[model samples]
Target: MDEHQGTAMKKKSSHASAITMNKDLEHWVSSEEQADISKVIQERLKDKKPKGKCDICRVHPAKSICIKCGNSVCSSCYFTMVGLCQNCLSKDTIEKWKNKKTDWKKILEVDWVD
Candidate 1:
C-alpha cells in the first residue's frame, strides 16, 4: 500500500484501540461496583478532626505571626506577604529577625486585637 493509505490505516487502528481501552476501563469499574467501594474508601479516609478552627483568627489556633506586622496568619497566608487580608512583610526583614541580626522588638510585639 502507499504511505498515505498506510498512515490512514494506522490512525484508524489507534482510534479503535482507544475506544476499546475506554470500554475495558468502564467495564472494570462497573464490575467492581466502584460507587460502593469509593463510598467505603471515603468513610475510611475521613479525618478524625474533619474541620479545625481558623489559624489566623484568635477565635482559632494561631499558626504563625507576620514578621513585619504582628498579625496571626494561617499556614496558607504565611507564604504570601501581599493581599487585602495579607499582612505584607519583606522576606529580608523576616530573615534578619530570625537570625537575631536585627532588633525587631517593635514589629515582634503582637497587637492584632484589643
Candidate 2:
C-alpha cells in the first residue's frame, strides 16, 4: 500500500478499537450504575471543601487556599490580588511577585488532579 493508504488503515483500525473499548466499558458499567457512581463522586467532592477554621487565623472559615503553601485561609487572611495567605506573604514575596497576575483557581486546583 501507498503511505496514504497505510495511514487510512491505521485510522480505521484505531477507530474500530475505540468502538470495541466503548462496548467493553458499556458491558462493565450500565448507565444507571454510572449515574449512581457520579452521585457518589459528587458527594465526595462536596465534602472536600475546606471544612474547618482558617489555617492562619484559626477563627473565620477558610474562603481561599494558598497557591504556594496549600493552606486554607479566610478572606481576611488571604490577599486575593496576590493569591497568597498571610503566612506566605512576606516583603520578599511581595517584591518577587509584584508585577505578576496570579490564577488562584488554576494554581490551587492543581493538587486535586493527582
Candidate 3:
C-alpha cells in the first residue's frame, strides 16, 4: 500500500517476466523447428560461392575464401591456421615464409601443389 511496497512489487514482477522470457527462449532454441532452421541455414551456406579470382595470386580459381576479409583464394594460396589468403597472412606474420616452417607435407596425407 506504501510507495516502497509498490516498488518491491514492480521489481518482483520484472524478475518474474525475465524468468518467463528465459523459459520461452530455452523452448524456442530446443524445438524441432529450430533444428530445421539450422539445417536449412547450413545447406544454404554450403551452396554459396565466393565472388571473383584468388585475392593472393589473382591467377588461380579461388577454392577457399577467407571468412574475415571475404577474400577468395585458391587452396595453394590459403593459410588454414590464420584462415586467410597468402598475402594477408604475410602481413600478419613476422616472417614471410612462416607457413613453410610447418611440416604440412609430412602431416597431411594429401598432396598439395603450389
Candidate 4:
C-alpha cells in the first residue's frame, strides 16, 4: 500500500460506482428524453445560417449553396459547365486562356445572365 496503489484503488472504485449508476439509470431514458435531446440539437443547428451572397453572380440574393466551392451563390448564379457563372469557372479553363485575361463572365445558361 503506497500512494500510487491507493490512488489506483480509488480510481477503480470510482469507475465501478459509475458503472453501477449507469446500469441503474439505464431504464430512465425514454422517448420523451430522446425528443428533448433532438429539440436541443435542432435549436443548436437553427443558429447556424450562412450570411452572404452567391460568390459567382453576386447579383441575385444568395438562396442556393455550393459545397464544392464553399460558396452560397444565389440560385441564378449556380450555373453549369459551358454555362457556368464567372465565379464557377474551373481553374483548367482559366489557364487555357493563357495571359489573355477576361472579366468575370456570367455563365450564359444562368437565368440572370443576358
Strongest candidate by TM-score: 3
lDDT of 4 at 16: 100
lDDT of each: 0.56, 0.78, 0.72, 0.62
Rank the candidate models, highest lDDT first. 2, 3, 4, 1
Off by over 4 Å in 1: 22-28, 31-36, 39-48, 53-114
User: What is the alpha-carbon lDDT for the whole of candidate 4?
Assistant: 0.62
Candidate 3 colliding pairs:
none
> What tens-digit string does per-residue lDDT give for candidate 1 at 53-83?
4344535554654444445556655655332
Q: Tell me the deviation in Å of residue 87 in model 3.
A: 3.5
Query: Candidate 2, which segments miss by more than 4 Å at Cα?
Result: 1-48, 91-114
Q: Where does candidate 2 clash, by residue pair?
A: none
lDDT of 4 by residue, 17-104 (tens): 9999989888767899879976865565454444476666566676644434446666566544333344667767655754565444
Model 3 clash tally? 0
Q: Each model's TM-score, in the order given? A: 0.29, 0.37, 0.38, 0.27
lDDT (10s digit) by residue, model 3, range 1-114: 999999999999999999999888786455788688658655655655766777778888888766556677888788776666666664646355654577676789767788
